[model samples]
Target: MNIKYNLVVLAAFCCTAIGSAQDIVTQEQAVKLALENNYGIKIAKQAVEVAENNTSVLNSGYLPTLTGAAGATYNLDNTEAEFSNGAPPTSLKGAESNRYNASVNLNYTIFDGLGRQYNYKSLKEQYQLSELQARETIENTVLQLFSVYYSVAQLTENLDALQETLEVSKDRLVRAQYQFDYGQNTKLGVLNAEVDINNDSINIISSYQELKNAKRDLNVVLGNALNPEFAVSTAIDFKLQFQKDDLFEKAKTHNVALLQTEKNIAISELDIKSNKSGFLPTIGLSGTYGWNKNNNNGASFVSVSTNTGLSGGLNLSWNLFDGGSTIIKVRNAKVNLETQKLQKENILIGIQRDFENAWEDFENKLKIFNIQQQNIITSQNNFERTQENFKIGQVNSIEFRQAQLNLLNAELSRNQAKYQAKLAELQLLQLSGELLNVDF
Candidate 1:
């Protein structure tokens, strides 16, 4: 019984650990999850659906529509009556009446001043534009995901650097104590070493807090529960391969906002045409088939009759005058179309400038990364020389500790530069509309 209880407790502990393990979603997995579950994206998707439905409704004007109707009614009346059987007769009577009718109506627009055509075309353009807007939302979500994921990883790397520094400081303190006991080092040296260790300890604590904050930020972006114990992959390589010229060219063609704006301008033009359609005549074909029934019950007798018939006709409607409302609407539509055209041009210019700026930022970050790589090498060598000198009693502990701190700073700078370069590359890719295609 004791052994069984121990086994059960061990199993429970293992199960709890597994359940509490941090979910490390990959970039692709994160994107897929967000597309499926992100509230903003879901709302955008619903908007797209509404646009599609509108398109369908607009298209329906071109198709024949059949409608059906049926109805029945009855009435009851009460009154006093008198009758004379001589040359004239006068009577007031209680009566009941009933009627039934049914009809099937059909309408086909043979011609509608071309309004339906223009409206349908405009709706199609609008639908496409909405889809493009949804794509833009997706791109933005992915950018946020990338930023959050890399931020968490960057903070984790900083923690590792701090921990390593802490360990090195502790080792130096131990050596300083032994050397002082053997009369090879001064008490001041040992005290300086101890102070450096204490500083590193503080740094480690600060780094831990930063890592926790980074994790929290990531969870918020991912729409996950805010728990700081999650783990993420920290090993990242920042080598970027891209051609600036190619990216710039792709941005002009593939950017979602630019494409969507162009579609908007097209739809605006169609809107102008549709609003002007009122001045033209509309032509249609209509048909109806129905059943009519009547029942009569009076003092004379009772009778019932039913009839069925079919009817068809051509229709033409023209609005010759409408208080100048049609003219005003046409002018307003024209103005709107012109405004949309100007807006589209402005958006194009903005996108071009954005692409150029992102490229510049990318190049600058790459240069910094290259410089920092050399700085790290130089700092590491200098720190090693200082360590040797301190061990041989040629230098004080202050010099050694400063050298160590310098190395740590150099490492941190390099890490920052590396990730900054990656971020800059990502920005450039996004501006160029290449992020969706990139395999990384």
Candidate 2:
């Protein structure tokens, strides 16, 4: 028997079931919109740039500093002088003195017990960690988008099925009314058909409302403005061809959380080095060039003087003790490093646990998908038989309605199972950190 258009066959529905005017989205297009407009992703990218800016040599204290200064001074006073031998005395009413000076200085830390190197390494690690965090945000956002998109598709399929049922009910009511008028069927039959039609209408309205809500949710995640209402295509497909061992390996290398924990451990080690550096001697180099001029009037000395010179020197500082502050800090840093090591181990264990569970779930969901496919086939065959009996008057209207409802239920169940399996697969991919690499 040929499956009728109202039965919602899985292979054919994707091609013709959805409304053409409303169906404006595909999974690929949805993903692209999310990447371009999602606010979380934009913020995360900015954070990565901040980390990049902090990873410079100047920020890591590996550069020299130069300073310049200039100043002028003037003085005026009356002056008097007397000879010690009492031969004469002298006085001047308007005596003036002026001086001008300018200087440039350069200072550089030549050595700091390798603390600068460790700090620079830490900055680089921080930058890498930011990149990992940004990648994680992208993956998580896209994952959410896929879930909502799939939901819209599921609801679209459900709405179509309900509309088909409503149409079928209306046709039944027309036939029932005609039969009653011709004395072929009783009034009770016509009333039953009417009641069923009302029920189908209600179901259609409810399904339609649910579909709109799902679309709205999808729009919000896609970063659409004003949460515009729209529809999506019912075309969807997925494949299950993953090996657990391969996923485990990928998680070890690509998982963002695990990588972040490892990075923190690296940073903690550097922190220990930085703290221990306080115990070492710091050596620095400094240079200064200065120019100065002075003019004197009515003075028993040189009338004008000028001086210019370049001065340079190296200085060293050794922190022999600081009330044991450095020792205490070193101890704390070592403890923190150990804690980070334990955290790394914990994260690794968690990744393994999550991957195993997700892999198991993926397999189970795929199995359920296969079973739903078979169940739909059985329901379809039974419905076809019931439909034939009803036409020939061998079966009643109630039996026909039951068969129709069964077929609809089967269609819904199979659609949900397919999407659930896809969701499970996506979870597995996310756990393995391979979601970012998915192109479609």
Candidate 3:
């Protein structure tokens, strides 16, 4: 029967608007706020932006570089000149000489064993990797949000149950007082009922402490720095069932870590090719335009000189030998590639193992939920019979308290089982890289 859920009437918790006291936050809204305000997510998204900015030909060496330069030098010195023809020697008291030159140059790599091409590809791959990393960050944050959010829900439910039982205790106290007035009960019976009332009060107070702490935790997860007073939906959707094979397949295909590792492998292979490019000839084209002027003061011949020119050239260079550094680099790149391949395998296996455990845990939690469901029914029924008997003086305070506590315990266990089962489902979806897709 659905009595377990109907008893609390909290399954529709998410839809209930916040009372006049506070705003009601739902799971989806919490995630959205965190995405907007969480610092870690902001940083991760910036990392992706940087990667995207790097994926350009200008940054990847596919385009030519243009540069401009200018410089001038001046000197003051005693000057003397001797002509090579030996006509005469001349001297001046102060001699001034200056030189100025400027140029705009362009250089382009025509080829380098296609290294630039590999570099471009690597940059694009890096961008993809960054995006995946950001996604991983987001998913983690979302999972954390759910965990803390669920804690708040569980505590809220428990607090409500405690308050409900407290009312029962109050009623019992009234009954005991009435019986005592009529001389049907002793002072001890009245004292016992009052003590139980006090104990329930203590339990409710303690639960309030716990519930407040849970709210603070939820506040942090929501990225609400102000910690404003708020309410949350206790309802979590647990109706979805998962299959083992489907999760396994989806994890292999979509798990952020696995996809990132695969990208690393591809980048590593590109690194090997990039390093091997060192052994091939590098051909490049270069051009320059320049202007220069020089003045020699107190000198014998041609005191002022000016020159300007445009120049262009093509060049090729081959690194025939480099003390085995190139070979070492190529070999290291290949080793890195192998390492990436190993990591990919390890991730694949790791996700599978996690899925195995989580799937089994999910199934077991569902079974336990069913068991708890049945147990609560029995507990509730027994409590009702005991309560009626106590009212008629057929049972004592201890027996009545036992029945009350049993029913309360059943409520707690059932709720705990339900929340735990929901957590398992979230974990399974997260492992399958479908948490955002499912929940959002």
lDDT of 1 at 353: 91
Per-residue lDDT of 225-278 in model 1, one digit per residue for the tens? Answer: 434566676555653466777777788888877787788779888888898888
lDDT values, one for every candidate: 0.76, 0.82, 0.83
Q: After best superposition, candidate 2 residue 81: deviation in angstroms?
A: 6.3
lDDT of 2 at 178: 86
Task: Write the residue-wise lDDT of candidate 3 on 1-440 in tens digits.
Answer: 24423322332232132123677787778888889987889999999999999997669887899999999999888877788997688887767789999999999999999898998999999999999999999999888877887877887777777766877877888888898899998888878877776666666666666766887876776666434567788776774555678778988898988989999998999999999899999999999999999987867478898999999999999989999999999999999999999998999889989989988999999899889999999999999999989878898999999999999989888889988998888888888888878754
**Candidate 2: misplaced stretches above 4 Å?**
1-23, 74-98, 225-230, 295-304
Whole-model alpha-carbon lDDT for candidate 2: 0.82
* Model 2 CA lDDT for position 7: 32
Candidate numbers sorted by TM-score from highest down: 3, 2, 1
lDDT of 2 by residue, 259-350 (tens): 88889889989999988899899999999999999887664567888999999999999989899999999899999989988888888899
Better of 1 and 3 by TM-score: 3
Which model is ahead, 1 or 3, in terms of lDDT? 3
In model 3, which residue pairs have backbone atoms overlapping below 3 Å? none
